[model samples]
Target: MENNSIWVGKLKKLEPSDYTMSILPKLRIHEENVMEFLRLSASKPEHITEILKMENNSILIGKVNNLIFSDYAVGILPRLGIHGENEMEELGLLAEHFEYISEILRMENNSIRVGKMRSLVLGEHAVEIFPKLKICEEGGIEEFFMVTDNPENITEIFRTENKNISVWIRKAKKLRLENCAMQIFHNLKFQKENVIAEICLSADCPYHITEMFKMENKSIQIGKVKRLELNCYAI
Candidate 1:
């Protein structure tokens, strides 16, 4: 698409006028699998939308694996000259999947309201833009993500009781902080004993756990050395 010659060549071959036969069927369903290739192959081929809208009830359908609207459709909307916050609102009415729009925004390293970031099975990087994001108000921390790069978010989730207490327990163990993990375990409203034992086994520090045993053995050995010194001094 960067090359003007290739752009001219494709248009000359399809001749814009012949797009009905040459292009329209490719967008028939949500795969956009076809259009993904087509759009990147050509630059600013906005007329593709015209071909799509020409069909009966131009409203888009949700994809097979998707919870709501088609991700592929939301992605191409921007290329069709639909962009920005207000544009999102316009498309929001038609969209079955709001998460896909959030994903598109994430791809661009952009942010949106936490309400729009719902059904967030993906887009981990996008949600990192808060306290700008009101995730707790929308649902809770667990509603958005699981593993995060930020430790602050981990503490925030625990503080809000946004998930099962065991989640925070596991996270604290993962961070390898024994004292904090112990405190979190004590605070849990309900506890899973098996899971707690598993975390302790995984988190055990051999040196710290055996410190008193090691010191007692060293003192007994030190008494034998003191007896030897006394015997030499008497000789």
Candidate 2:
């Protein structure tokens, strides 16, 4: 157990459980009292100590834990200068409050950019926040790999029959599926700069660019050729 004296300057400076024990009780003292104490707890640790002295520490900690990860707590975290509880939970909240988030709210944005598969499906505004390729990679409508926000920009040409991915990207350039990107090579702007060299030099991408590398023409290359695999082979 840590000395509560360490929490004299800022409640956020302490671990979440400790801070929750110290501050939730004070804020929860009044049923109407909500996030007002968050600002104070973040800025004045002595004030927190005073309140802690009056709380039933064990009871407060228990109660707070029961609600700390609830949706209500998600809104309060940003106010208290906290971002999230952990990687997965935070992503879900951030995906919900996409418009209000900034780069400073979190340390890493890579995983968040692609978003969890579940979030990409659920994020109502996810198309606006994530890159087309990233959104597709995370799980997106097959054909909309780029932007077209206005009504005038909506063209009858791209609207395919049934979310069924029928060579939409191939007709457009590459191929996309009903649910995700088959790959991004046909985006033109992001085509592989050295795919042939990378594939010839590395075996990891054996079928990734099979047509361009002509992996089927074993006479042109030399190696222990293994069985080919479909993208959805396991499924």
Off by over 4 Å in 1: 1-61, 66-145, 159-190, 193-235
- Each prediction's Cα lDDT score? 0.26, 0.25
Candidate 2 on 133-230: residue-level lDDT in tens? 12223222222232212212212223332112222222222112111122222222223231211111111233433333432342333122223223
Best by the TM-score measure: 1
Model 1 weakest 10-residue run by lDDT: 82-91
Best by lDDT: 1
What does candidate 1's lDDT look like per residue over 24-94, in tens digits?
A: 33333332211111221212234244433443223222121112112233333322311111111111212
